[model samples]
Target: MDRAPFHPGPPAEVTATPAGDRWTLRFVRDLRHPPERVWAALTDPARLREWAPFLADRDLSTPGDAVLTLVDGDAVVAQPATVRRAEPPRLLEYTWDEDLLRWELTRTADGTRLTLWHTVADRGLLPMVAAGWHLCVDVAERLLAGDPIGPIRGAEAIGFGWTELRDTYARRLGDA
Candidate 1:
């Protein structure tokens, strides 16, 4: 498999919707992989380590409770989360800290359409969160393509690509 050069771009489509005092950030991406494959990456801890910002202590394939450890450089913060919903190869949702993360997958003509909806309590952190998810999805694509890259997270992620992507998303989200 041939891998394309890394492109630091915002998501294909991202929307911020205000609901009450919180905001929901939705990221849409069409991945060139099957839903089953994508689902594995989303729930499998070993695969997540290749792309996600956190590692799970247990399999998230079923609806239940699990611990997620947020990884940043050499730092780790463990948080308990309940799998609010789980439908294999289609949907998975859970709570992250004070927020909720929902992943929806659909089979597309060429591959799969992955949509991530994250609810955040602090609207001020929208830019940072959006940028981090952008990088995460990008890494996920690479990992699924058989050309994985090292994780860029924690202070490294917030200070690195997060800076530029945050500015771009901030502008797009009208938060600038």
Candidate 2:
């Protein structure tokens, strides 16, 4: 799909570690809902299953932040993550492995603008991660609006510019 990921604030920066070999993909979407409503979909396990499912048949949402054990039948994937930043509905940040993700939401005239930044320790994994996030965030948007969810995610650009998009959000927020 040729859907656009919308945002209206200054985008945060995601960089490589001291290793200097990491890839990070960030997704932003201006949602049509309040911060409290948006927070519910993110923190709630049942609500998260509707969107943000990393594995096809696994529940990744658990309150109080701990090592997440994701098992689909036999195979299992353990992800170490925590709620790094939580401010009601303003921001929610966390870390999974060497990657850090932050979703910052701001109240707007129309709705809330949510920006997600995902840092990957492996550059090769960018494409898959980006595409999956696109789909999940779109689902999240639909969920926030009380609308039917759809499966739609765009392809990842091999070389998606970061600063340009970040600057765009920064400018828009300034104007807003």
Candidate 3:
């Protein structure tokens, strides 16, 4: 039997909240997989490479300093990160460069609810950030379902409707 093609859904459910001088983008996604499975994808280096926007040098399951290399085709930029909190398949908070990322995983009746609070210095980048993460989680969900479509991020995401999602998110989120 032929497999069905994968097409990412619409923009994720995201909202922007003010955090000191910076802004925090709250992105929520519900997956059909459990928390343990999703947590591995978010913490494991090899699994992160398959879906995340960056490649982790070490497992993010522990609280410590780690390096995350952002790759955009031939361009690779290594950024310093610190895992401030790690609570198994529940909460994981870390810093990526100057930005702070907090992940909360809650078990749901159907599967798991994943919420990402990313603190960024710029408010204008919220929509773009949401769009990028929208694709990342979508791909991650696919990977968990045993139907990986590879990672969609960086410049390459433009070819996979990233621009459209960004625009849509911008309109949905509006300017505050």
Candidate 4:
């Protein structure tokens, strides 16, 4: 018998809330892993490269200034970032370029519940962002489970059903 390939079904649960001039998209996902383990994947630079959309120059486990390089195909843009808060395996807040990302990990009976609050100035970008995170989270879970399908990001993400996910999110999230 052969195993079925991993295929992310749809976008995760996300809510867009108005925040003055910006919009905050809250994405919640339940991973079958402990908070401590999830925290390592979220903050470790080496681990992030395996599942994230960006590559961190250093570990994001501390509160301080850091650099995050976003890659799209051969285009790599290094963005200056600041880690505003880091609370071990619980909470983390940081900035990626002009966008602010806050992650909260709560321990659940099954595993860890990860909630991401991302604030972006462009409301039109919500669906796209949501789609990106959906793929990232799926990859992250696989990595945590020791299956490791590698990272799906940037232009390469389109090959992994990015368009469909984006469209689904756009419909679900509405005109934003």
lDDT of 1 by residue, 50-165 (tens): 88889999889888889999998788999998888999999999997788999999999999999998899877677778899888888888889888876667787754467888
Pairwise lDDT winner, candidates 1 and 2: 1
The TM-score between candidate 2 and the true structure equals: 0.62
TM-scores of all predicted structures: 0.92, 0.62, 0.96, 0.96
* Alpha-carbon shift of residue 91 in model 1 (angstroms): 0.5
lDDT of each: 0.84, 0.56, 0.91, 0.92
Q: List the residue pairs that clash in candidate 1.
A: none
| Per-residue C-alpha lDDT of model 3 across residues 1-176, encoded as one tens digit per residue | 11246566866788999999999999999999999999999999999998999999999999999999998888899999999999999999999999999999999998999999999999999999998999899899888998887887699888877888888888877852
For residue 170, what is the lDDT in candidate 4? 88
Clashes of 4: 0
TM-score head-to-head 2 vs 3, winner: 3
- By lDDT rank, best first, the candidates go 4, 3, 1, 2
Error of 3 at 74 (Å): 1.1
**Global local distance difference test of model 3:** 0.91
Query: Which candidate number has the best lDDT?
Result: 4
- Of candidate 2, the 10-residue stretch with the lowest lDDT total is 150-159
What is the per-residue lDDT of model 2 for residues 1-176, given as tens digits with 9 covering 90 to 100? Answer: 22355331233333322235655555667778887788777766667655664322222233345554343335557777776677777777777656777777888888887777777776545545544554566667766666645333222221233334434433433311
Clashes of 2: 0
Q: C-alpha displacement of 105 in model 4, angstroms?
A: 0.3
